[model samples]
Target chain A: MRLTTARRSTLFAGLAIASVAVLTACGTASGGGDSGEEATELGDYEGSVSILAWPGYVEDGSNDPSVDWVSAFEEETGCMVESKTYGTSDEAFSLMKTGDYDVVAASGDASLRLVAAGEVAPVNTDLLKNYDGIFDFLKMQSWNSVDGVSYGIPHGYGANLLMYNTDVFPDGLTSWSAVFDDAAANSGKVTAYDSPIYIADAAVYLMATQPELGIENPYALDETQLAAAVELLKAQRQHIGEYWSDYLKEIQAFETGDSVVGTTWQVIQNSITTGNTEVVLPDEGTTGWSDTWMISSQAKSPNCAYAWLDYIASPEANAQATAYFGEAPSSQAACEFRDDCEAYHAGDADYASQIWYWSTPIADCLDGRTDVECTDYAAWTTAWQEIKG
Target chain B: MSSAATPHVTAGVPQPRDTPARRISVFLSQHARVRLGLLLTAPLFWLGLVYVVALAALLITAFWTVDSFTGQVRTEFTLDNIITVVTGSLYQTVTLRTVGVALLVTVIDIAIALPVAFFMAKVAGPRLQRILVIAVLMPLWASYLVKAYAWRSVLAEGGVVDWMTAPFGGSSPGYGLPAVVITLSYLWLPYVILPIYAGLERVPDSLLEASSDLGAKTWRTMGSVVMPMLWPSIIAASIFSFSLSLGDYITVNIVGGANQLLGNLVYTNVGAANNLPLASAIALIPVAIMIVYLTAARRSGALENL
Candidate 1:
């Protein structure tokens, strides 16, 4: 009996270990498969498309009855829309790898990773009619394209602008210095965006202030440049009242005067009812994000996914979507559908040029340097923890 | 079978029904080891699968690496992530800060809970005790996010704390480590109080009266008698507060100013950075800490109270 019990226990242990091995192997094996090939021509609509998108991007009237553009697309294309919202790009990345989603709205940070992992296929712009109307400046960027092959359709873009309370800065601050070199002026009332990506914001500041550091791209930071940025952030950390990842946290902080100066999005500034705050581009430019709509490599509904890409990029749908999300629309024609387009500087290439869109930092330097290995996202994460310490 | 021939059966009494339940009881009573095994099987399987296996998987993942560009987990065995977590100054500092904050929160909770629990368990009348218990439990029913956000407003500059303290030339601590500690203490207070309250209830009132009747002062009675008996309870309560505080990221995110704890490091690596191996490695810190804490608690006989 004792020998049999021992044998049974050994079997159970072996089964548990085997199950773990299977689970781990599944994770590793799912990556880098041939995504088959990009569709050269559209077939019949598969009658449905499963969309994975940022919140408010693919509204189907489920959240707010009136704030939906998806219904119209569904009606016109005869494609049933089943959508899931992800809170962050990382979540969207993992969700896309499940091969459950037909189309994904990927930010620059997630787009390249998806492309590299073969989770998404390249887009043939010829197959999309609305692709032509997208802003020229928004097209074929490093984030959305690799080796000149476009991977997705441009959706919307927004910058992380510097916002300050008028009560704190009566004369108004003109530079990112207010949050960096002069952050001590505000002392414990200053705030900043809370993310590893915010490390690029500090790098952006360093590029303008200390040009001797030879920092070119905010996203492309070699070991030494990243160290410089980390040091600068460590200094700024002393004055930060709090770092906010949630928009509501920042808005409440501003309203209560706990945070008098911080990086904010245009949407957050608009949501502040007190009118005591204002957002500026600042002299040093800013970090921003641009989203793209890409079809999953294993899309079950390729035609419908293509249809979604075309439909969402159309003028009226794009206007409603971008306006609701508080970002500049992807096209000049989209601006024609809304009166407040000028407020977001829609279709303005010059303003867009001043924004450095968020991109996943990799060992391969994004700034086209061949000599030094740039720091990756993991490194930034480590540095961010240290900075916050 | 004839009733007259059945041994140990009463001649006049009706035979007990030989139903399924009777058979089951008869079988279970006779095979004691089998019955015990049957009773434990489901829970043992649940515990093994959900806790042990999941933990083992996490530990295995910690030794693996990720392809930085693709965010894909590479299952090849490598100690790089664990090594980084151990040797990295960032992890060390965050771990220290986390432990410090957790300890402070536990101490504060204990300090607050002792008096309140003493009142509830000893001083208060039965009706009042019931009311106080209900009141202590009321906050737990509300969503945790709601409470954290409410505290955010309460601790905001020129908000409730400031408005109240302004008369004394003081101000809100604002969003920072202090706010984090304060909010966490508030959040875990009920957990601390209940354990201590239950412990206090278990101590006989007659014992307290006898101590006093023996010519001991009230403070002397509490210090010499009540406190020593309360040690296990205090340790049990401390376990709750300490582990809860150690694993908290959301409360800190809401009010911790620019601070990041061990939780935040784990969260950032998992959610934002998409580095699961590193996150798992960072997560081991709190698990290891809690293991040590639980071991110490066990040594002090706190597990009995639990």
Candidate 2:
């Protein structure tokens, strides 16, 4: 009975996906028809603007008395700010669909989905004085734009760095092989980011070591490429101490010697009280996020949204927000205000180019390959479960 | 009707006034079944809407699929998610691991609680019993996250466990499956202990005395009399620990050391992947297990105590 049920379910799943492909094509075409027009010019500021953002992006001194960028913007623009924070990109996407928020800070993974769903409007860069001051490398990427049409202004960016114990590697490591090829050296002490997206990290490693795989983009993987990446991860899993989704868990693991090596963000590294750990961007590069500040298509206060976007992109506000969040500021001018800009490799185009910013994987290959279908996020999710098992 | 007709009182005591509350009370007394239904309506409605309806929706969603790019739920029917969840070796392995951890937690709690509860119910003075119950309940007042983190530190290398064990040339278990089991067992211990304590309170002292008078030794009396009577409560307590452990993901993440459970699979699909259909399908494993478990427990008369 169980065997029959399993076989029937698999058959049904295949049929469902086949039917969904046709439905999705029609849905996207219709969704595109209603793409809200971008505001051509800014008018009088609306009295209030509702903002949805990641935590620490729009602080108004409520969390800390010192972090008060939103207050200054509200005073200067005459647009009262009411900010709500979302925990994940998926959450931001869902919240934007309500058409309640005037502006949102969306990471690359979410920005494209917002544009595809017609939840955000195209930006008129001419209206913003600070648009030119932002890094040239950060703008008009596939995630933040479609067919060269800019969806939003770049906010900030960061990479997932390889962190290791100073005691474990006295000479310091330069490659991700410490966590991939030589991971067994730290057997039961190795760790990795606990998400399907982390598969890209493995792909990044594979690209360097096994160049014959013809893997162009970490996010774009055909079935064979994805399977190869999965095999590498499954091998790494044998040496893994634990997979960590929470930063505090990772920090604790590192502090108590539970995890000697793993993938981590710069912010997590800075938060570690113990001085035994150091982070490095491996030679193979790493996956990272470049967030964009977008205005809602159904925004009630488009003018206020415009003003908030421009204000946030300005050097001082950008510095304050990015500095608090532990990421590279969007503009070189913003780096002048912060002392730790060097640590984040701010304004380094070469360093930025080495980073493959996170873009949601879809059926249409991100690398622009049309000959074969690339594995989507759903496929990765299934594969991640299998890898851990 | 007679009371309404005769308004004036013949006795010295004034006749009771026919207030709105009194009128409703009189009507309710005349119709016991109506009163019973009225009393049950709110609770029954809540159960149907929140529990039954939500469960049905989850099951329905399990048969659906989501658009990979847009993250929207497509209502098109498919057997794919259910098939993947059932046939996938990942799900099977996680299910077995989760069940093993849950069973171990339940058994550990039963072992610890039986002695602690027996002392609280039979040996301790009434004041001490109250204090012991309060002590057992105090940890529950603290947040679950705080306790889990506390355990993480205690079980860390060179931590409390290590410090205490070092004198005897032993070390802490460190973070792994053992850590997960230890933390879960501690968290669910109170839930187990209280039910058994309540069961022990119901066991009359006279029964024990009578068994002793009938030439039954202490061990014989406990095995022949107390064990059979306490069986239902023990089963009820096991259900709490077992099910809670089975559905847990957070504790495992914090301390399991490279492990994932059924809850983690469901959580990742829903939160990270945004595949609600897949998550719902994965969630069905624990629900199905619980149903099978509850059926077995019901045969032991544990459901009545619960």
Report the number of the highest-TM-score candidate. Answer: 1
Each candidate's lDDT (Cα)? 0.90, 0.89
DockQ, every prediction:
0.57, 0.34
Interface RMSD of each: 2.1, 6.0
Per-residue C-alpha lDDT of model 1 across residues A1-389, encoded as one tens digit per residue: 56598899999888887978876776554447565577799999888999999888999888899999988988998999999998778788878878999999999888988998889988999999999999999899999998999999999999999999998899998899999999999999999988888999999999998899888899999999999999999999999999887788889889888899989999999899999999999988999999999988889999999999999999999999999999999998998888898889988889998999999888899999999999988788778878988
Real contacts recovered, all predictions: 0.76, 0.56
Q: Provide the lowest-lDDT 10-residue window in model 2 chain B.
A: B4-13
**Tens digits of lDDT, candidate 2, B70-143:** 66677778999999888988889999999999999999999999999999999999999999999999999999
DockQ of prediction 2: 0.34
Residue A265 of model 1 has an lDDT of 93
Off by over 4 Å in 2: A1-34, A97-100, B1-39, B304-306
Q: TM-score of the candidate numbered 2?
A: 0.90
Task: Itemize residue pairs with steric clashes in candidate 2.
Answer: A241-B257, A242-B258
The TM-scores, one per candidate, come to: 0.93, 0.90
